[model samples]
Target: MEFNFADRMSDLKGSAIREIFKVIAQPDIISFAGGVPSPDTYPVDALNEISQRLLVGNAAAYLNYGVTNGYPPLIEILKERLTKQGVVKDSDEMMITTGGQQGIDLAAKSILNKGDGLVCENPSFIGALNSFRTYEAELFGVTLQNDGLDVDEFKKTIKENKNIKIAYIIPTFQNPGGVTTSLEKRKKILEICKANGIIIIEDNPYGELRFKGEDVPTIKSLDTDGDTVIYVGSLSKVLSPGMRIGFVVANSKIIGKMEILKQVNDVHTNQFAQALAYEWLKNYDFEEHLEKARLLYKHKCELMLKTMDETFPEFVTYTRPEGGLFILCTINKEGIDSAEVVKACIDKKVAFVPGFTFMVDMTKTSNMFRLNYSTMSDEKIVEGIKILAGVLKTL
Candidate 1:
C-alpha cells in the first residue's frame, strides 16, 4: 500500500542532536553532543519526596484531567515569579505547555500564516526553526554577533522583505552559540520590531543557568505595550526535562487563542507532572539548587575552555559564553568541514554536533561546530577535548 503524507513532511528532517545521541550512547564514548543537564545535579531526592506526597495526599487532583491552560496553582506561582522580573503582570497572560519547544510551536502557529516571514539568528535553535517551517514560514537569517543579533542587518532584512510576521530570538544564552544579547541591543531589536509591526517570540530556556554576569532583562519585560513579545520559558534546564513543564507569557488575547489551540493538540499538559512541579516550586529551595547547578556548569565550562586553549590549534576559535551548555567553535582553516570533524571524533569515541545542522540551510557548509560541557565530568571533558583537538589538527 502506498501512503500519502502531508506536504509539510517533505522538508522536515530528524533532529541532528538526537541522531548523534544514538552513536554516543556507548559507555566508552565521551559525548559533548547533547545540550543536557548533568545527572549529578538532578534533584532526585526532592522530587521523590514530592512524588510520594502527591500520590498519598493529592492523587485525586493530580491523576485527573487538568485545564488546557495548565495547573492553576503552578500558573499563579509562575506568574508571580515573572511579575517580580517585570515580564508579565497578570496570570491570564500565561499558558503552561509541555515544554519550551511546544511553546515555540504554539507561538508560531498563532501568528504565522503560510509563507509569512520570520527573521531569526543565522545559527538559530533547530527545534524553533523546524517549528516555524511546519507552518511553511519563510525564514530570513540575520547575522548573530558576539553581543547579540546584528540590529542593522535585521532592520535591512525587514525593510527588504515584506510580510514578516515575527522576529524569533533566544536573546539570553542562545543555544548552539551560547551568546547572550546585550541590554542595548535587546532594546534596539525591540524598537525595530515595534516600528515594523513584527511580533517578537522570545525563547529563553537557558537564562536561569547564568553563572557569571548579572541577569539581563527579558525582551518581554521591555515591552511597554505588553502585546509585542511572547516569552517562552522552561523548567527543563532548571528542574527536570523528563517532567516536561514549560510556559508561554504573552498578552491575554494571544494567550487565549493559544489555549484554544492547545485543547486540540494534547487536550492539556500532564496533570501529575504539573501538580508535582507546583509542589516542588512551593516547597523546595530552588535558588540554592540553581546556584549549585550554575557553579557546576561554570567549572565544567572553564575546564573545557582551558583544555581547548592548550590543545586546539591557534587557527581555531570558540565563543566564551557567560553561561549556557554550549560553545561554538569556528575552525579558521579553509576547506575544513565541521561534519568531517564530528565523524572523525566519533571514531575516537568523542562527539560534538557540527554547526551546519543548526543552520536554516543544512547543505551549506561551515567550519564551525558546537560543544556541550554540562553533562560530562572533568576527566571526561579533558579526554574529549584532547581527542577533538587531535581531530582538528589532522584536518
Candidate 2:
C-alpha cells in the first residue's frame, strides 16, 4: 500500500542523535550522544514513596482525565517557583505541557503560519528545529558566539527577513553549544525583538542545572509586559524526563492560545507526574537535591574537559561551558569531515552527535560535534575521550 504523507512530513526525518542512540545501545558502546540526565542522581526513593502513598489513597484522581491547562496544585506550585525567579507574576500566565519539547511545538502552533520565518541559532536544538519545520515555517540561521547569538547578525537577519515571526533561543547553557548568553547580550536581543515585534521563545530546560556560574536572569523576567517572551521550562533535567512534565509562561493571551492548542495535542500532561512534582516541590528538599546533581555533573564535566585537554589533538578546540550537559567541539583544520571522525569513534565503541545534525540545514557539513558528559561514568568519560582522541588522530 502506498501511504501519502503531508508535505512537511516529506522533509522530516528521524533525529540523527536518536539514530546514534540505536547504535550505542550495545553495552560496549560508550555514548555521548543523548542529552539524558544521570540515573544516579534521580530521587528514586522519594518518587517511589510518593507513588505508593498516592496510589494507595488518590489513585482515582490521578488516573482520571485532567484539565488541559494542567493539574491545579501543580500549576500553583510551579507559578510560586517561577515568581520567585521573577519569571511570572501569576498562575494565569502559564500552562503545563508534556515536556519542554512539547512547549516548543505548541509555541510554533500558536504563532507560526506557513512560510513564516523563524530565526534560530545555527547549531540549535534538533527538537526545536524539527518542531518549526513541522509547521512549514522557514528557518533562518544566526551564528552563536561564546556568549550567545550574534546580536548584530540577528538584527540584520530580522531586517532582511520581514516575515520572521519568532526568535527561538536557549539563552542559558544552550543545547548542542552549551554556552550561556551574557546578560548584556540577552538585553540587546530582547530589545531588538521587541522593536521588531517578534516573539521570543526561550527554551530553557537546563537553566536550573548550573554548577559553575552565577544565575543569569531569564529573558521572560526581562519582558516588562509579559507579551514578548514565551518561556518553556522542564522538570526533566532537574527531576525526571520520564515524567513528561514541562510548562510555558507567557502573557495570558498566549497561554490561552497554547492551552487550546495543547488540548488538541495530548489533552494534558500526565496527572500522576504532575502530582508527584508538586509533592516533591512542596514537601521535599529540592534545592539540596539540585546541589548534589550539580556536583556530580561538575565532576564529570571537569574530568571530560581535563582528559580532552591532555589527550585531544592540538588542532581540536571545544567550548568550556559554565554549566549544562553538552560541550561543542570544532576541528580547527578546515574541511575536516565530521562523518569520518564519528565513524572512526563508533568503530571503537564510542558515540557522539555531529554538529550539522542540530542545524536548520542538515545538508550542510560541519567540522564540529557535540558531547554530553552528564550520563557517563567517570571511568567511561575518561575511556571514551581517549578512544575519541585516538579516532581523531586517525583523521
Candidate 3:
C-alpha cells in the first residue's frame, strides 16, 4: 500500500545542492558544491576536552532535558556576544536553536502562513528559501545589486505587494552570491521594512568569518526599538557545525512563541552539544579560533579566485568575496544550462551547485552557478577549478 503525504510536501523539492552532493560522493570527485566549513578548522581537541569535562563534572546538565528556550548559560553567552556585535539589545531576548537552519525554520513557522508574501534576495540561501516554501508562502524576489538589495526595485516590490510578512537577508558574505549588503543599503532595508511593518529575518552565520574586510553593523543592530528585526547567528561556521548550536535574537514576545515552537520541533536543541559548546567557549580562546578559521578560508578563497582567473574563459565572471564560503559565477554563454554543466563536471570528477537552486524562478537562472571554497584544500580547489574549466570549454 502507498502512503500519502501532506499537500505541502507536494511542492517542496529536495535541495538541489544536497542532490548534487550525493552525485559527487565518489572519491575522485572534488566537490565545490557543499557549504561546509573545513573539518581541519574544527577545534577537535578543545571539544574533546570540553565534552569530557562536561560529562565528568556536569553530567546532570548534559543528560537531563533542557529548557525549551535553550541551555540558559549558552543563551546568556550568546546574548553577551551578540550584544557586542550590535544584534542583541539589553531589552531583547534570545533563543537557542539546533542550528542556524532551525532558526530559519522556526522564524518561518512562527510568522508565515499560506500565500503570505515574503521578500528575499533574488538568489538567496536555498535552505532558508526551502524553509519559507514549506509554509506555502508566496515569495517575491528582490534584485541584488553590487551594494545590496536594489532599493528602487524593493520599494516597487513592496508597493506592489503590501502584505509582505518577512524580508529575509544574508547581509554579510551572502551564500551563493558572496555579496555583502552595504551599510547604507542595510539602513535603507531596515527603513523599508519598518515603514511597511515587515519583519526582517537576518541570517548571519558567516558574519564572524570575515578575513579581509571591515565588519559591518548588522541590520538588527540598527533596530533601536526592536520593532522590526530578528537576527540569527550560528556557531556552525565559527565554532562547529556538528555541535548544532545557534541562537536567535528578537523581541521577547516573538521569542516566547518561538520557544514553544522549538519545544515541539526538537524538544530543545541537543543539551550535550550546547553544554559542550559552552564548555569549549569557556575554556578556549574563541577569538583565536575564529581568526584561524578566517585565515584558512581566506587562503582557500584566494586560491579559487586565482585558479578561476588563470583557467576560466574571459566571459565567465565571479564575485570576489571578502569572506564566507561561496562565490557566484555568471557564465556569459547564452542558452548554456548550468545544471547540464554541473552534470558534465560530475562526470569529470568535479562538482559545483547550479544557480537555479537559489533562484525563485529556476528556468531563468541557467547561466549561473555557485562555488564553495571553505570545505576543500588548496590542491582540491585547484584541481576542481581545472576540471570545471575543461567542462566549461566543452559546453
Candidate 4:
C-alpha cells in the first residue's frame, strides 16, 4: 500500500546540525556543531537538592495534569523577573513552552498560514528557519551586518514583500551570525514592523550570556505596549537545556492563541522541570551562576578566536562576537566550496556546521561556516582549528 504525507513534508529535511551529529558521533571527532550550554555550568548540586525535595514532598504537582500555560508559581516568578527587566508589560500575558524552539513554532502557528510571507535575517537560526518553512511561509532574507540585520535591506525587503505575516529577529548575541543588533537598528526594525502590521518574534536564547558587551535593551522591552512584539526567551543557555524551560511574552491576544496551540502541542512543558527552574531562579543565586557561565564562555570564545586568527589562512574572515557560542566564518576567495572544506576538516576528525543550512534559501551553496566555542574544551578548540587550518591551506 502507498502512504500519504503533507505537502510541507515533501521538501523539508532534518536540521543539518542534528544530522551532522549522526555522521560525526565517534568520540575521537572534535565537534563544533551543537550550540548547547556547557555542562560545567549546570547547577547540579542545587538541582539535585530541589529534585529530591520536590519528588518526596510534591510529586502530585509534577505528575498530575496542569494548566496548558504553565505551572502557576513558575509563571509568576518569570513575570516578575521580566517585568523588572522591562520585557514584560502590565497589559501583556505569558506562556511557558517546551523550549525557545516551540515558542518560535507557536509564533509561526499563530500568525502564518500556508505561503504567508515571513521576514528574517539572511542566516538565521536553523531551527527557526525550519519551523517557519513547516508552515510553507515565503521567507524573505535580510542581509546581516556586523551590528545585526541591515536596516536598509530590512526596510527594502518588508516594503517589497507583501503578505508578510511575521518578522523574526535575534537582536542580542544572534546565533550563527554571532552579532548583536544595535539599539538604533532595533528601534527602526520595531517601528517598521509595527507600521507594517508584522508581528515580531524576538528569539533571544543567548541574551543572558553577554560575556563582553553592555546589555542591549530587547525589542520586546521597547514595545512598551507589548502588542507588536512576541519575546521568546529560554533558560537553555544560562541554565539547562534539558529542563526544556522557555517562555513567551506578548499581548493577551497573541498569548491566548498560543495558549490554545500549546494545549494541542504538548498540554504544557514538563511540570517537574518547570518547578526546578522556578526554584533555581527564585531561591538560588542565579545571577552568580550566570556570571560564571559568562566568564567561562568568554575565555573559550577568546581562545577560539585567537586560535583562528593565528592558524587559519588570511583568506578566511570571521565575526568576533562579544557573546554567544558561535563564530561565523567566510572564505574570502572565490570557487572554494564550503562543503569541500567541511569534508576535509571532518576527514581530519574536526567538524563544524556549513553555513548554507542556516540560510533562508538552501538551494544555493555558501562560502561560510559556523564554529562553536562553548561545548568543547580549550585544548580541543585549539586542536580543532589547527586541523581545520591545515585543510584550508590545501584549498
Candidate 5:
C-alpha cells in the first residue's frame, strides 16, 4: 500500500546542517559544521548526582504524566532567570519547552496562518525558517548589516508588505552569521515593529556565551509594555543540550495558547529532564560554567581567525564575531560558489555548511559558508581551517 502525506510537507526542506552532519560522521572528518556545544563543558557530575537524587527520592513525579505548562518550580526558576536576561518581567508568563527549537515551532503554529508574511534576517537560523515554512507562511528576507537588520530595508519591507505577522530575529550572537545586532538598531527595530503592530520573535540561544564583548540589552528588554515581543531561551549552550530544556517568555495570554499547542506537540517536555536541569541549576555555579564555555570558544575562534587571515585567498571575507559558536566566510572569487567549496571540503574530510540554505531564495548567488568553532579541539580547529584553506587555493 502507498501512503500520502500532507500538502504542507512539500513546503518544508530538510535541514542543511543536519545533512552536513551525515557527511562528517566518519571518524576521520574534522567538522566545523554543526553549532553543537562542546561535551567538555557539560556538568556531567552534577547531572549524575541530580539524576540519582531524583530516582531515589522522587521517582513517582518523573514516572507520571505532567502538566502541559511544565514543572511549576522549573517555570518559576525560568521566570527569575529570564528576568535577569531582560527577556521578561517578574509578572510575565513563561513555558518550558522540549528545547528552544520546539518553542519556535509552537510560536509558528499558534500565531501564524497560511500566507501570513514573516520577515527574517537575510541569513537567518534555518531551523526557525523551516518551522515557519511548515505553516505555509510566506517568508521575506531583509539584508543584515554589521549593526543589525538593515533598518532602511526593514522599513521598506514593512511598507511594501503590510501583511507581516511577525519579525523573527536571533539578535545576540546570531547563528550561522555570528553577528550581533547593535543597541541602536535594536531600539530602531523595536520602534518600527511597535509602530506596525508586528510581533518580534527573539530567539537568543547564545546570549550568555560572550567572552570579549560588552553586554547588549535584548530587544525584549526594551519592551516596556510587553505587547510586541516573544522571547526564547535555551539551557543547551550554558547547561546541557542533551537534556533539551528551553523556555518561552511572552505575555500570559499568548503563552496560554502556546501551552495548549505544546500539549498536542509532545504532551510536555520530559519531566525528568526538567527536574534534572532544575537540580543542576540549583547546585551548580551557572556563571562559572558559562565563563568556561566562553573561554573555550574564544580560543577556538581565535585559532580559526588566525588561520583564515594567513591561509585563505584575498577575496574571502568573514565576520569576526565577539562571541558565539560560528563565523561567516564569504569567498568573493567570481566563479567559486559556496556549495562547491563545501563539496571540496567534504572530499578532503573537512566539513562546513553552505550559506544558501540560510537564505529565502535558493537561486541567489551565494559565496558564503558558516564555520563553527565550539565543538572541536584546538588541533582539530587549526587542521580543519588549513585543509579548507588548501581547498580555497584550488578554487
Candidate 6:
C-alpha cells in the first residue's frame, strides 16, 4: 500500500548520520560519522546530584507542563549570558528552544513563506539544510573558502536574487566544512544582508569550544542595528545535549511570532530539562567544565589532523579546523564518487558521512567526506584513520 504525505514531507527523510548510528552499533566499528560531543566531557556527577535535588524539592514543577517560552529561570539565565556576549539588547527577546536545531527550524518557520528565497553555505550543516527545505524555501548555496563563506559571491547572489528572505550560516567551526567566517567577512555579510533586507540566522552550537586561533565576534554582536540577525546558541557542546538547552535572540517582533509557533508546535520545551539546566548553570563551575572540554577536544583535533596528514594520500586535502568535531576532506582527483568511498570505509569497520548529505543538492558531487574527532577515543581515532587511508589509497 502507498501512503500519501504532505508536500513538505514529500522529499524529507531521516538524517544520514543518524542512520549511520544504526549500522555502526557494533562495538568495533570505530565510527567517526556523528557530530556528537565526547561522553567523557559530560558532567554526569553534577547532573546526577542536581536531578536528585530537583525531584526531591520541586517535583511538581519538574513534572508539570510549562509555558511555550520555556522555564522562566532558564530563560533569564540564558538571556544574561547572551547579554554579556553583547548580542542581545533591550529591543531583542529570546526563547529557550528544545535544542539549537529547533531554534533554526523555528526562526525559518517564522519568516519564510512557500517559494521564498533562502541562502546558505555550499556545504553547511545538514540539519539546517533540511530545516530550511521543509519551508520550501528556494536555497542558494555560496561556496565556502578557507576563512569562511564567499562574501563576493554572496553580494552577487543577493543582488541577482529577489525575495531572498534569510541567510543561514554556521560562522564558527562550521559543520561539514570546518571553516570559520573571518571578522571582516562577518561585517560585510551583515552590511549586505541588512541592505538587502535579508534576515541572518546564525547557528552557533560550537562557539565556546574554540581550541585555537582568536575568537571572532558573532554577526549579531556586530549588528548595532539589532534587527538584522537571529543568534541561536546551544549548551550541548559544553553541558549536555540530552537536556536540549538552547536559546535564540532576535527582535521582539520575530521572537513573539516564534513563541506562538512554539506554543502550537510542542506547547513548550521539556520543563524538567529546563530546571536541570537552570540549576546547573547557576550553581556549577560551568567555566571550568568548558575549559576542560576545550582542552580535550583541542588534543583530539590535533591528533586527528596529524594522523590524516601522515596516513591519507596527499591528494585528499582536508581542513585544519581551529575547533569543531569535523574535518572535511575533498578528494582532489576526478571521477571519484564519495558515496562509494564511504561504503569502502564501512567495509573496513570505519564509517563517515558522505559530503553530499550536507549539500543543497545531494545529487551534485562534491567529492568530499566528513570525519569527526570529538566522540571517539584516541586509539580508535588513530586506527580508524589508518584504515580509512588504506581505502582511499586504493582509489
Best model number under lDDT: 2
Q: Looking at candidate 1, what is the lDDT of residue 168?
A: 96
lDDT of 2 by residue, 179-226 (tens): 999999999999999999999999999999899979999998988664
C-alpha lDDT of all candidate models, in order:
0.91, 0.91, 0.87, 0.90, 0.88, 0.90
Give one digit per residue, the lDDT tens place, for model 5 in 1-395.
77698878976779988988888888899999988889899888888888999999979988788898888888887777777767777556899998899999898888899999999899999989999988999999998777778989998999999889899999988988899999999999999999999999999999989888799999999998756898988988888787899899988888999998988889999999998888777777888888888999898899889988999888889999999888998888787679988987898899989999889776675889999998888899888899998988888
lDDT tens per residue, model 6, 224-263? 8649999999988778888888889999999999999899
Estimate the TM-score for candidate 3. 0.97
List the candidate 3 regions with Cα displacement exceeding 4 Å.
363-365
| Model 3, span 46-114: residue lDDT tens | 878777777789698689998888888888777778777777777688999989999989988999989
Q: Which stretches of candidate 2 lie over 4 Å from their true place?
A: 90-92
- Worst-scoring 10-residue span by lDDT in model 2: 88-97
- Give candidate 4's TM-score: 0.98
User: Which ranking of candidates, highest lDDT first?
Assistant: 2, 1, 4, 6, 5, 3
Using all chains and alpha carbons, the TM-scores for the candidates as numbered come to: 0.98, 0.98, 0.97, 0.98, 0.97, 0.98
Report the error of model 2 at residue 73, Å. 0.9
For 108-172, candidate 4 gives per-residue lDDT tens digits of: 99899998999999899989998988999999999988998989988888888888879899988
Pick the winner on TM-score between candidates 2 and 5. 2
Clashes of each: 0, 0, 0, 0, 0, 0
Pick by TM-score: 1 or 5, better one: 1
**Deviation from native of the Cα of residue 338 in model 5, angstroms:** 0.6
Better of 2 and 6 by lDDT: 2
Best of the two (3, 5) by lDDT: 5
Candidate 6 clash pair list: none
